[model samples]
Target: MAAPDELFCWEGAWGLPSVSSDCLTVLAYAQFAGAPLKLRKISNPWRSPSGSLPALRTNQNETLSRPADIIIHLRKQKFNADYDLSAREGADSLAFISLLEERLKPALIYNSWVDSKNYVEVTRRWYAEHLPFPLNFLLPGRMQRQQLETLRLLRGEESLEGGEELEKELYREASDCMNLLSQRLGARKFFFRDSPSSLDAYVFAYLAPLLKAKLPNGKLQQHLKSLENLSSFCSNILLLYFPHDARESSGGQKSSSPPQPEGGDYDHVPNKRRKQLMSVLVALGAMLSYAVLTGILSIQHMQKEALEAPPPDRQTLDPLDEDEEGDG
Candidate 1:
């Protein structure tokens, strides 16, 4: 278990999915306002079929096979039934995924090959200047080589002439997708609804990687910087979930007096850790009270019936119970 308010992972350099998932965890903590939850960031050596990275495990003895499984597990812990997704919200999440597949994926495919005269030149120049030497060497060259091999296999040398046309198609698709996203975000504090939703988390994750990419002449950088609200939202969530000590170390200042323990004896040191632990305990007590009041964690017979009901088949694991009957 993590100490209160201690973040298990670092942020900023992480990929889209990881960042978005972290944000979801932060949101869960914020909603509870309870004891800080442990964040176990695993760096799994295995890769998924989609070529994505796998999660690291916190407990050496325990395993969570997939991201969805992790989400379900989190849902079972101190779950707020009020946070359950409605039918419409579920459909919207699916729609967001579909849109990304239709738009972003095609653009990625096309951009790999022939560079776009319109956007490609600008992006290429940017990448050349800002991207790290290793990445620049790997990404563009690999993409171009794959494109050449694909062209050769599909159309022979004759089809090479139409590469520019394919590139143009890709640019069109990507631009269209970006425009749609911008329009959807117009005037609204969030993308999916009034408050941030699961869909928003996914969108933020996918876009964060693109936003973090080195841009030419800092054009893309400037664009992202201008989105103050979005940036603030991201930063606020980070700080809340990943609180850190900010006190400055005093190397120059001399100690006025020797540090003394209570009762004239070297004893317990009063420090931030002790203070944080107390705060966490208090928060936990408050949460238990609220849960009891709301019937969210009630022990009433009828409420127990609902809580004890077997989770739907979609969930492979059984809910943890106070007794052995709940164990899977």
Candidate 2:
């Protein structure tokens, strides 16, 4: 028997199995196709062989990072979610997925990364809390930068300046896309009426995050919730395919405490004490380095001070010895 492929992906949060839309797409597709995989849920992307999340390490030793490439590779292994899709259905799938990318993706990026409130409170805080030490200090900001760049590219602009005008345009297109999807999915259990397909995976990935996340600024989320069918669609998929995560999400909501980091699987506070120690050490080292670099505290200066200090009172020691002889 061949060894199962290993999938490294972002840890789940917000009751969704993986916070990343791309990772959710791949995961849902794999589940729909019945592909057996060893899942390695991780908060740190650097742990993945490809140095990114949603990476696949095949039994053949090939590592794939992009979700599209990973899906293509899975199809080659006869794990195809779209195998049952009719020719017209397949064409429709491509069209709708394209529509989502062109219309909805920019909005998702904006709300998650470019929107100041959501980025600071929900998105950045989630990753920063879940990510292991040192990286926790750096990667969230870097990821935001990358997401912003991606959003700019999607908008076909050399640079993006967030404003009320830009927000209105993005939300308008996103709402239009959601309405279209809801109309197409009117009363069906799945996009194709019965069986799940890649289209289902794609739509679910995009909508689930927006629906489930507790964003401070949730204009898109409110619109999605108003579309009853689309909201049910995401909920149904979560219950059917990802029951464990669904349970976790429900449990988290009922509790008074804040949601724990990634469900005790990925950096789940097992190394929290160690990370705290390392964080303190790193902070101290940084402070010491800064002091030395700025000439505030110098090793050579301390050494010179020690060397120039007056010798201890040899006469004082001799007086104690002389007093002892007199007593004798």
Please report the candidate that would top lDDT against the real structure.
Answer: 2
- lDDT of candidate 2 over 1-328, digit per residue (tens): 8999999999999999999999999999999999999999999999999999899999999999988899999999999999988899999999999999999999999999989989988898899889986898899999998998888888886468658888899999999999999999989999995889999999999999999998878889999999999999999999999999999989977872355543433445446798789879989999998888898446656765787743366447877999999999
Give stretches of model 1 more than 4 Å off: 1-52, 56-62, 78-85, 106-164, 192-194, 216-328
Q: Rate the local accuracy (lDDT) of all candidates.
A: 0.45, 0.91
Model 1 weakest 10-residue run by lDDT = 245-254
Query: What's model 2's lDDT at 305?
Result: 77
Each model's TM-score, in the order given? 0.42, 0.82
Compared with the true structure, the alpha-carbon lDDT of candidate 1 equals: 0.45
lDDT measured at residue 246 in model 2 versus the true structure, 0 to 100: 98
Candidate 2: misplaced stretches above 4 Å?
257-328
**Angstrom error at residue 110, model 2:** 0.1
- How good is model 1 by TM-score? 0.42
